[model samples]
Target: MNLQAVKILFLKDLFLSRRQLFAYFAAGLASSALTTIPNPTVSFVGFLLMITVAIASGIHLIGTLMLSESTDQTRLFVMSMPISLLDYSVGKIAVILTTYLIPWSAMFASSAILTFVLPTSKHGSFAVLPAIFLFLLCAFLIQLVTAVVSESVGWTISVMVGCNVGLNVFFMQLFASPEISAAAKSDSVSWPPVLIQLLTVELLIAAGALVTAFIAQTRKRDLV
Candidate 1:
């Protein structure tokens, strides 16, 4: 594996995503500010906005970054370089994960903190935010794999739509579970085994999808 090539590819991807990165940061800051508002209704709106912004940012950034090579007709230029398919895959994965995770984690943490401070009667539902985030991450990974493997704009969009809809289903199922709902009622951080197991599965699936995508790329003899 060419470490230098991987680094170059990663840096190039990051550079291309710099503008989206700025918008993500702005969204985070705006959401954070809204959370600080004293009114309960306004604060709740802020929380919802934060969730929306985080999900949208992840989708937009990853979608654009993954499709950029093909959309811009730069795949041939990139393929002509010293980079291998594995290296390129690893670089793109690293770039997208780093760009998406940091903001998502921050937003999740803030929501968790907010849940801890608010009354259980009103804010109990918010406690499941982290688990919901794990599901979102899983959904995002599906789109990532679609982007990496098919590289078809239409298929990628379909996967995104399906994942978005699936998110609601997963959220409802998880939140409705007695164990998870009970965990959400706690005043402190709760990491019940059930939730932990669920997260582990999501993480594993994401890792597997990434590996599969890398292998698929490596086997391709006719990449443009």
Candidate 2:
């Protein structure tokens, strides 16, 4: 594999992703700040904004760093370089995953902090927010794997939309669950049995999907 060429590709993708990442980070921070206020309507708006930040970041990064390269004129130039398919595969995985994780991690940390700091009544169940964030991560991984394996914008977009809908339904169900609503009165974070199982499932799915994507990449004859 051409390490230098891979490094260049990684850097190029990172540079291309900077602006969208900044906007996502800013919106996530804003959402966290919104939790500081006690208004229900404003907090609801904030929750929506947080979801938007998470989903939008994934969509943009997938397009700009992963899918766009395949359609761009750069594809031919990249293929003609010293880079092998392995190098291209490595660069795509590293660049797309790293670029996504930065803003995602920020959003995760901010949500965790907000969940902890905010009153139980204001945020509902403590573990719920973290679970939601994990779900988003899982959803993004599903999108990532879909894009990596299918290399089709249509499939990726379809999965994204489906995941988006699933997320909304999941969010409502989590909040509405008796375990979550009951724990909203507690001062401590509640890890109800069902919630714990859900979190574990999401974690497993995220890890499994990523590993699958890497395997598919390794077996590929072409990355361009």
Candidate 3:
């Protein structure tokens, strides 16, 4: 792999997509703020906004940094360079993570802090936030894979529309179940195995999706 090429690609991508990056960060922070509101209706709106930001952020990055790269003149310029498939894939993955994860981490960390400091965990148990945040992270990774590997606008958008919002809703409902809520409320430290297992599965799927996307991108004969 050409480390220099990867570095160049990262800087170029970041520079090109800087505006979107800032917008996503601000939107995520706004969602976090709204989710902390004391009102029930407001809080629900915040929750939906958070889910929207999660999915929208991923889609925006995929379009500007990945999908758009293929259809525009920028991609041609990058391809003219001495970068290999591995270098290109690594650069794309690096930029996607950098662009998405930094803001995501900030929003998530703030939410976690507010959840405990303001004591707003749904069932009064802090464990619930981790489950919620992890699910979003996991979903974004799978969505990233869809966007990168498929490289088909229709397929990528279809998968995003079909899964991201629905999975978020399903996971929210799952955590709200009586069993999980009871366990979360009963013991803050010792969470139920079901929650733990779900978190583990999310992590595993995220890791697998990332690996799959990387391999698929590298194996391709062309960028698109």
Candidate 4:
């Protein structure tokens, strides 16, 4: 791998993404403000707002950093540079993932803090927000891998739709399950065996998809 070239490409993407980065932080701050309201119903709405911000920011960044590269002119410009395709792949993935994680982590930490501060009688169920964040991150990873590998707008859109629908259904099922609901309400954080197993599977899928994408990039003959 061309480490120097990778660094240059990464810096290029990072520089170009600065505007989107600022917007993401602004959205995160707005969501945090909403969550800080003392009303339980309002806070719940705010939490939903936070989720929307996170997902939208992720999609926007993916489009800017990954999907745009698939266009003919952009592909030609990038390929004309000194970097190999592998360097481009590593740089784009690293830059996009790192950029996304910044806002995601900030929003997640704010949500966790808000959940903990919420009154037990009103919003104690917010404890499950962390688990929900994990699920969301898994979905983001799947979308990222799909964009990087397939380079097809249709596949990416389909994955986004499936993830959004599936995540809502999964959370609803989790809330409905007696054991999981009980765990969510406990005085302390509880990682029930089932929750642990589910999270493990998600992490595995995400990791596998990322590794597979890198492998595919290495073998790819056409940069365009």
Give each model a TM-score. 0.87, 0.89, 0.89, 0.92
State in Å the error of residue 79, model 2: 2.4
lDDT of 1 by residue, 28-108 (tens): 777966876778788779877876876798788766787877988888788888877778778888888888886787777
Query: Largest TM-score belongs to which candidate?
Result: 4
Estimate candidate 4's alpha-carbon lDDT, on a 0 to 1 scale. Answer: 0.82
Model 2: colliding residue pairs: none
Q: Report, for all candidates in order, the number of backbone clashes.
A: 0, 0, 0, 0
Better of 1 and 2 by lDDT: 2
Where does candidate 1 have its weakest 10-residue lDDT segment? 118-127
RMSD of 2: 2.2
Please provide the root mean square deviation of candidate 4 (C-alpha atoms, Å).
2.0
lDDT of each: 0.77, 0.79, 0.78, 0.82
lDDT score for candidate 1 against the true structure: 0.77
lDDT of 2 by residue, 60-154 (tens): 88887778877886767877977777777678778877877777787777777776666545444556766888888889889988987888999
Candidate scoring better on lDDT of 2 and 4: 4
Q: How much RMSD separates candidate 1 from the native structure?
A: 2.5
Choose the strongest candidate by lDDT.
Answer: 4
Candidate 4 lDDT tens digits, 67-170: 88876458678889887888888888889888888888889887777657756432445556656877888888889888988888889989999999987898
Model 3's TM-score against the true structure:
0.89
User: Over the full model, what C-alpha lDDT does candidate 2 score relative to the true structure?
Assistant: 0.79
> Which TM-score value belongs to model 4?
0.92
Q: For candidate 1, what is the total of clashing residue pairs?
A: 0
Error of 1 at 215 (Å): 2.0
* Pairs of residues clashing in candidate 4: none
> What is candidate 3's local distance difference test score?
0.78
